[model samples]
Target: MPLEEIQHWTWVFGRAQQMMLDYSLREIEKARTNDPETPMSGFAAAGGAMLKAQTDFWSDSLKLWQRFLMPEEAPSEARALSEEIGRRADRDKRFSAPAWRDSPLFDLVRQSYLLVSDHLLKGVDAIDGLDARQKERIRFATRGFVDAMSPSNFPLSNPVVIEKTLETRGENLLKGLDHLLSDLGRGQLTHTDSGAFEVGRNVAVTPGKVIKRTPLYELIHYQPTTPQLMRTPLVIFPPWINRYYILDLNPEKSFIRWAVSQGLSVFIVSWKSADAGMKDVTWDDYILRGQIDAIDTVRDLLGVDAVHAIGYCVAGTTLAATLALLAARGEADKVRSATFFTAQVDFADAGELTLFVDDDQLSVIDALANDGFLDGRYMAATFNLLRSRDLIWNYVQNNYLLGQDYAPFDLLYWNGDTTNLPALWHRSYLTDLYRDNKLVQPGALSVDGTPIDLSLVKTPAYIQAGREDHIAPLQSVWKLTEHFAGPMRFLLAGSGHIAGVVNPPTSGKYQYWSHEGTAATLSEFLEKAVETKGSWWPDWIRWIEALDDTRVAARAARMPGKGRLKALEDAPGSYVRAR
Candidate 1:
C-alpha cells in the first residue's frame, strides 16, 4: 500500500478509538444517574476498571523499557555508547550523535531514542502469528521510523549543526539551502560532488581497448603489464546495476590493472545503461547476448579452450545460471574455474533486501516500470534506504544542515553513477529469484532453450562473502557451496559490501577468515576459521596459479585489433559513460 494511504487509514482508526472511549464515558455517567437508588459503588467500580486498563498498558511499556537498562545484560546500543564515550574523551567525533555530550538533556534524548529503538526491535522478535513476510515488513517499517526520529535529524537537537551555523555566522544555512535546491532540481540526492570526477579522464583511466560490442554490453580487453602470462585468460562480469568502473576506480585501486600486472590477461563486460529502446531485453539476453558472448570472444582472442571467470554481485548470480546452462549443453569446459564475490544464487536467506520484495511490492514496481525501465534514481533510493543513517541522513546533515560539500571518495562517486534496469529483466529477477527463489530448484530456471541446474556445474568454485554485507548476507552466500558438485573454497571477508571487496593488501585494513574444510553451517565454518591479516587478493592469486599449470615465456601485450574480435573503441567504452 502507498504510505500516504496507510497514514490516512491510521488517522481514521485513531479517531474511531477516541470516539468509542468518549461514548463509554458518557454511558457510565448515564448509568449512575439512572441507578440513583442503587449505590454509586458500581460507577466507582467501572471507573476503576478503566484506570486499571490504562495502568496495565503503561506497565507493559515500562517492562519493555527496563530491558534496555538491564545492568547484567547490556544491550548492543549501550555497549556502543560506552565505547563512543571513550572515543569522545580522546577527541574523536566521527559518530553521528555528537550532541549527546552537550548537555544532560541531550544525553537523555539519546538514551530515550536508543531505548525506544531497542524495544521496537525486540517487539518485532516477540511478535507471533505473523508470517515471515509480515514480520519482515514490520521490522523494516520500525527501522525506518526509528531512523527518521534520530536526534541528529533536527537542527536544534544536533549540536554539530548548531556549532557550524554559529561559527559561520549563519552563512552555512544559506549554502545548505542552495545545496537542497540544487539536488531537488536534479530529482535525486547527491552523494558526492559530481563535478569533482570524470569518467574516462581520472576515474576509469586504466589502459585498455574495447574488443567487442553488443546491444546489451561492451567487452574491454585490458593491456597486459606483466613479463609473462598464464595460459588461461580471465574474464570479469560486473553487476549491471552500477558501472563496471567500481573494479577499476583508479590506478591506486584498480583491480583490473592489478590482475593484468599479475601476468593474467583481463577482460571485463561493461553493461549498457538500459533505456526505453532496450526495455524488451530479458534475462536470457543478459546470459546469452552478454556473458556468454563475452566468454566466446575471450576464448577466441586467447586461442584457449577455456578461460577463468569471476563474477561480482548480481553478475555473479547470472554467471552461475549461465554456467548451469552450459553444463546442460555439455559445454561446461568453456570456463576453467569460477569465482563469485558477494553474490547469492540461493535467495532463501537474502537478508533485508527481501523485506521490500513480495507480490505486492513487485506489482508496484511493475507499474512504475511501465515506461520501459525502472529509473536509476528509484534503484538508488532503495539501496540508500538499506543504510539510511550512513547513506541518506548523513548526506542530508552534511550537505543540507551543516552546509558541507562531499569530498572526492571513489566508492561514493561510483555509487552516484547509477544505471537503469530494463523492465522485463528487472521484473523477471524479482519474481523468479527473490519471490519464487527458483534458481536453487533444478529446471526451475531456463536460458536459451536449456534448463539450469547449478549442481550440474562441475567446475571448481571459489566464493567469498562479506561478513557485514547487508545486501547479500554471509549466510546466504555460503549456501552456494551446498549447490555446487565441484570442489569449493569459501572465504569470509571483513567490512560491508564495497569495502570488503575493494580491500587491498597495502591498506592492511580488514581481516579475512578461512577454514580448511567446509562445515555443515555458516556458524560452524566461523567456529573453525583462522584469521589472516591483509587482503584476500594474494590468496586468490595463489589459488588461480594452482589451477593453471602452464607458465608461458614473456610476450608483448596484445593490441585491440590484434585479436580476431577487432577493436570497437577505447578503454572505459561508451556504454559506461552513457549518463
Candidate 2:
C-alpha cells in the first residue's frame, strides 16, 4: 500500500511488460474479446444457463436468510449444512483456519460462494448447440474463473491469510509478495522445494546404466537385484510428457527399483526434453525410433527374442499404437506381454482433457506451437485447471497470502517438471488419437509406413487404471479391452494417474481391485473385482512372471565405463537432465 511498494511493483511490471511477445499479447487481446477458440454457446443456451444459475443462487440465499429469521429446530437445510461441515474435503488443511469455522461472517461467505459455484459449474451440461467437447471447454473455463475468485484466494477474504498477517504484524504479506516476485522471475510457479532434490543424487537414484542414447531418448538398464534374473527382460515406456524419474522418485516409491529387485532386468526410456529442432519429429519417429528402438536395444543387448513391456499414461496409449504397428508388420513376437497403466485407447469417453484439442481450440494450440515445439508450460497450466481448487488456488493462498514456501513434494516436483513436444508429434497425437479416436479404429493410423490395427495386437495384456484418474478416464482405459484380441486382465487402483502407477507394496498405501474374469464394461469389472488393500505392484509382478517365469543365472555388470554397452552415465542419463 506504500509508495515505495507501489514503485517496486511498477518497476517489476515494466520489465515483464517489455518482455511480452506479440503473439502472447494477441492471445491476451483475443481472450479479452471472447475469442472464437472458446466460443460461448448460442444465446438461448447460455442465457438459459445464466438464468438457472442466478435463480438457484438467489433461491439459496433466500433460504439461508429465512433460516436466520425463523429459529427452527434442525431444519433439513441446517442438518445438511451441519453434515457438510463435518465432511472431509472442505475441512481439509486449506480451510483449517479457526475463523473459517468459528466466524459467522466467513461461514456465510463460504456457504454463499459454494452455492453459486455449484450452480455455475453445472451450467454447461448438454447445451443444445454445443458438442460434448465444446461443452467441456465451457465447463472447464467456468470452473477456472470460479476457482480463481474464491474467498480463500484473496488476502482480505481468506481467514488464514488474515490470521497470518495479524500474527506476523504484516511481515507475512511482505514475504508473500517476495515469493510471488521470485516465481514471476522464474517463469513458473514453484510447486516444491526445488533446491532439496536433484534427479540422479536422490530422486532417480536407482542404480542403473545408460545402455543406449538417441536423439529422442536414453535407455537405462537397471542392475539386477535378485540372484536369478528373469530370462525375458522387462522394458518400460513412460510418458514422454514427463521425465521418467516419476517411476523412480525414491526407493520406497520407486517402481523401477522394486522391479529390478524382483529378479527382473528393467530397461526404461528417459525421453529427451525436446528443443525447437524436434518440431518436425512426427509421431512415427516417436513410435519407431523412441519406444520401439529402446525395446529393440534391450533385446539386442540382452540377446532375448522378446521383452515384457509396460507403458504409462500417454506412453501406454503409444504402446497400444506400437503393439498395433508391430502386429501390422508381423513382428508382434518382439513384445512378449504388454501392461498398460491408465492408458486410454478410446477417446469417445475421454474426460476433461478433450477440452484442449476440440476443433476451435486446436487452431490456437497449433499457433502456439508455431515455434516448432509447444512449450510444456501451456500443457502444464491446462492440467492444473483439472484440479485448480487444490493444485492452483490453495497453493496461491499458501504461497502468496499465508507467506508459506511451497513444500518439498517429490510428486509435485515431477508434476512441475514438464517436457516440450514436437509440433508434428503434438498435433498428430491430439488430432489422430485424441480428437479422431483412431487407435481403436483398425487401419486408421499408420506409424512407420504400416497401417496399425489394435485388433491384430494379440499379445497377452494386463491393463491397470486409476479409479480417480482425471487425465485418462477409467472407462476410456477399460475400452482397450474391446479392440485388442489378446487375453486381457484389467485392474483398478485407488489413487490418480501418478500414485496409482508408482505404488509400491512396501508403503502399504492404496487398494487395488482385480477381476479374474474378463468383463465388458468398467462398471461390471469394478462390481465383481475383489478389493485388496495395499499396492498392486505385487499382483503385476506375479502376473508378469507367470507369462514365462524362466530364470537365468544373474550376469554381473561389466567394469564401469569399460564394456561394449559402455555405460554413458549412472542410472538417469543426460537426456533426463535436459531442462
Candidate 3:
C-alpha cells in the first residue's frame, strides 16, 4: 500500500483501538442489548436489527393504510406512531405546517422521516462499545444525516414548497435558483440579507472614538450619555473570533449604548481578523497584546488605576487567563470588577462544540491552516451545524425551495460575518484548552512565562450564562465559579448565547434568574433563585454601581481625532473592517 493510504487506514483503525482501551470487551458484551425491536442495537448484532427495521417499516406502512380505510373502529397499530408525530410537531417548528397535518401524503412523509430519525438516534444510544464522547460524535453525525433528510428540505417532499411554486406559477423556483447562485458566489449560506447593516453607519452607531490602536486591537472610548460619569471605566473584550460590533450592533439592541446611557464610559476591543500576516499569533500574544494592551490603554487614556472589564464568549475564556496572569504579576487590581458573558473557562462539559476536537479531527484542521490561518468559514460552519435545522436547512428551504429573501436582522448579519483564527492560536486552543482541559488547572498553562493560577484572582465577578446555550453549556460556565477566588454572582438568562447576552431593558424580552449566593450545583442555586420579569442589564448595572458609585463631573474630553493615544479614525475602527 502507498504510504499516504497506509496512514489513512491507520488513523481509521486507531478509533477502534480507542474503544478497546476505553472499555473492556467483557463490559461491551455485558452491556449489549438483546431487544430485537431496538433497531441497530449494537454493532455486533446489527444483522438482526437491520432485518427488524425493514420488516417494521413495511408493517407500519400497512397499518397506516388500514387505519385510513377503517375510520371509527378499534385502536390501530399506527396509533403510537401518530401520537409520536404529533408530539414532535408540537415542539419543533419545522413540521408545524398546516399541510403536514391536513394532507395525508405529506403527513406520511413527515411520519416516516421521524420514525427513522428517532430509531437512528436510539440505535446510537444502544451501542455498547463506545464511550460518552465517542457516542456523542456518532449522535452528532446521525443528526446531520437526519436533518439533511428532513422532508422540509426538499421541494418535492415539502408541501410549502409545492404551494409556493403553484402560487407563483413556478417563479419561486426561478428566484430560488438565482438565490442559490448568489449564495454560491458569496461562499456561505446567507442567514440575513447581504449589505443589510454596515458598521459605523447604522449597526455600530453608538457614538465613540478610537482612542488607541495596536496591531492586535483598536480601543474605542464610547461617548458617555450622562452628565456625571462613574469613577471606573468599562472595557469590553469581545472574542477575536468575531467582529466587536455584536455589542455595538445598532442603538436599540447595542449593549454598549445601554451601558453608556447608565453613566459609564465604555471601551471595546476591536480585534483585527486574522490574515496571513497574523499566522504566528498565539494565545499568550492574544492575552498580552490584544486584551492586556486594550486594558492598559483604557487606563492610560482615562487615568484610572482600575477599570471594569467584560468578556464575551471566547474572549471570556481568554479573560479568565488574563485575570490569572494579572494576579501572578501582582497587578490583580488593574481590573476592579469582571463580568463574563456566556464564556467557558472549564472545557470539561463544553457541549456539542467539542465534537470538532474529537476523533483525531484536530489534525485535519491543523493541516488546513497550513497558510497560517484557519478560515473563519470552518468555524462558522461548525456553529451552524450545532443548530443545523435552524441555521442551515431553514435557509435552504426558504431560499432554495420556497424562494424567499433574507430578512434584515443585525444579529443574523453578525452571525454570518466570519473571522479567521491564527494557526498557532487555533492549535493551542484545541490541544491546550479543549483537548488537555488545562485552563481550569492552576499553573497548568502560562502566559508570557508566568504560571496562571485562577484561585489567586480576587476581583469580584458577575457571570451570566444562557440556559439554552449549546456552544458553552450552562453547567460548563458554572464550573468557572469553582475556579475563581472572588465573590461570584451567577445569573441564568433566557435564550441562546448571543440573544441572552445582547438582551436590553428597553426590549422587555426574556427573563433572568439570580441567586443570592453560590451553591454546590446549578440545581441547588435554582432552588432558591429569584426569577425576574425582564432583561438582566438593569440588575447588572446596579451590581457595578454597588462596587463603586463614585461620580465625577463629566468632561468634554472625548474628541476622536485629538487625544493622548489619539483617535486614528472613529469608533468601529479599520481593524474591525479588515476581511
Candidate 4:
C-alpha cells in the first residue's frame, strides 16, 4: 500500500478505537471465515493480552482523570501523573486477557502503532539487502523478538546506529527509530555509476587541442587553457567504477588545468559507462581497444615519441593490465613511460575490501546480474556501505529527521550519476581480478590468450600512492614496484585516493615524498624519501620533461578541423554522455 494510505487508515482506526472496544479487531475477524480462532490465534492472543491491559489502564486513567481535572492539582502535575498512569497501564498484566482487552477506545491507537512498525520493518529489510554493515545493528536492536528477529551480521553500521539513537528520544524509541532512520539513510546515499566528465569550453582550448580516434575509443584530448605552461603532456587513466573527469573536477580544482599551466599536456580517458551493449566488453577491450589504442593515438598524433601515462585507482590497474599485456606481446616499444597513482597491480594486500569478496557475496552479485547487467543503484549502495557511518548517517540526519533536500557537491553529484555493468564482464572481473588475485602473479592469468606478466613491463615507470588510501592501500600500490622489470620510481602522495591523483602544484593541497632508489616495500620507501612541499604535479612534469626532448610544433588541424572524427553525439564526450 502507499505509505500515505497506510497512515490514513491507521489514523482512521485510531479515531474509531476511541468510540468503541475491539472495533478493528472485530472487523478484521469478520473478514475471515471458518474459525478466525486458528489462523489469528496468535494475533488474537496478542490482541486479547493488549486489550486487557488497556482496559485496566483506562480504569486507572478514569480514576486519575477526575483527580487530573480537579482544581486541586496543577495542570502540569496532573498531565505528568496521567502520562505515568498510561505507561504503567500498558505494561500491567490485568490487561493481558480478552475480557477487558475489548476496549474500542485504544484499538485505533494500537492499529497505528502496529501499522507504522510494519512499514518500518519492511523498510529495514530493504536496507539489509543494500548495506552489509547495518546487519549487526539490525540484529542488536531486534534481539529476542521472534517474528522480527535480527539476522547474523558483522557490525559495520554500529557507529551510525549509536549516533542516530543519541539524537532522538532516548531508549523509549531507539529501536523503532533506528530501523526506520537507517533505511532512509541507506536509500539516499547509494549510487552505482562511474564518474562524470565535463569538457573544457571550446574557447578554453587551443584550436585542434582536442584529439580522438576513429571508433573514438582511444582519446588524447587537451583542455587547452594552462595557468603555467609545462613542457610535456601527461595522460591520466581513471578507474572504471567512476568516470574519468573526477581528477579534473572543475576549472579551479581541475588537475588538468593546473598541469597545463605548469607546462604539461593533460590528456584523460573518459571511459564510456558500461551497459547491456558492453556486457561482452572484456578487460581486453579496455586494454587493447582502450588504453593501448590511446597510447598509439597520443604518440602518433602529437608527434611525440614518448609521453607520460598516469593511472588513477582502477584506471591505474587497467593501465597496468594494458602495459603488462603489451609487454607480454613484446609490444612495449610503441610508447614512453608509465605512472600509477594509487593503482594496484597486486591485489593480495589490498585492504579491508576483501571481507566482501567471499563466494556468497559474489554469488549474490551474479544473481543480480542475471539479466545481463548490475544496476547502478546496487553498486552505489555497496560502495556507500563501505563507509556507512559517513554516507549513511549524513543522509539519515539530512533526509529523514531534517527533511532536507540533498545539496549537490560535485564529488557526490558525480557519484550519484550511476551506470550498469554487464553480468558476464562483472563476473569475469571479480573472479580473475578480485577473488583470485591472478594478474599480480606472473602468468597466473591470461587476457584474451595473452599471458599477463608484470615482470615484462620494461618501460620506465613512476608510481604514486596515497599515504592514507583505504581503497587501494599504499602498500598494495607499492607492490607494483617489485614485479616491474623496468626502472621504477615510487612516490608517496600525502592525500587519499582522489586528492592524491589530482594533486596540482598550484592547489597546495598536499606534499609528496620521493625516493631515489627502488625500495622493497612502501614503509621502507616512506622511511627513506625526501619530504617536499607543493603537489606531485610539478615533480611528475619535471620527471617526464627529462624523458621528453624538445620538439618542433606539429601542424595544427585545418580550419574547422578536418573531420577525422565523427561527433559521438556532442560535448561531454562519449562516456559522460553514456549515462
Best by TM-score: 3
- What TM-score, over all chains together, does every model reach? 0.85, 0.88, 0.89, 0.63
Clashing pairs in 3: 203-250
Better of 1 and 3 by lDDT: 3
Each prediction's Cα lDDT score? 0.80, 0.79, 0.81, 0.59
For model 2, the superposed segments whose C-alpha errors exceed 4 Å read 1-54, 68-93, 125-131, 556-563
Q: What overall lDDT, based on C-alpha atoms, would model 3 receive against the true structure?
A: 0.81
Better structure of 2 and 3 per TM-score? 3
Candidates in order: C-alpha RMSD to true structure: 8.7, 9.7, 9.4, 14.9
Candidate with top lDDT is: 3
Residue range 1-579, candidate 1, lDDT tens digits: 354553454345435544655654555565556566545446445454543344333333333233333434646554565445435433523233545555434543455456456657766755656788788888888998888887777788777788889999988889989999998998888988788899998899889889888889989988777667888889999999999999999887888888888988888999999989997899999899888888988887777899899999999999999889899999999999999999999999998888777777788888889879988888888999998877888878888999997788878889988899998899899889987899999998889778899999898899999989998999999999889898888999999788889887778889899998768788899999999987888889988999995756444335555667677888999999998
Model 4, runs deviating above 4 Å: 1-220, 223-233, 554-570
lDDT of 2: 0.79
By TM-score, how accurate is candidate 1?
0.85
Q: Write the per-residue lDDT of candidate 4 for residues 457-485, one digit (tens) a residue.
A: 89888888898886888888888888888
Alpha-carbon shift of residue 553 in model 2 (angstroms): 1.4
Judge candidate 4 against the unseen true structure and give its global Cα lDDT, from 0 to 1.
Answer: 0.59
Model 4 RMSD vs true structure: 14.9
Candidate 2 lDDT score at position 29? 45
How many residue-pair clashes does candidate 3 contain?
1
Order of candidate numbers by TM-score, starting with the best: 3, 2, 1, 4
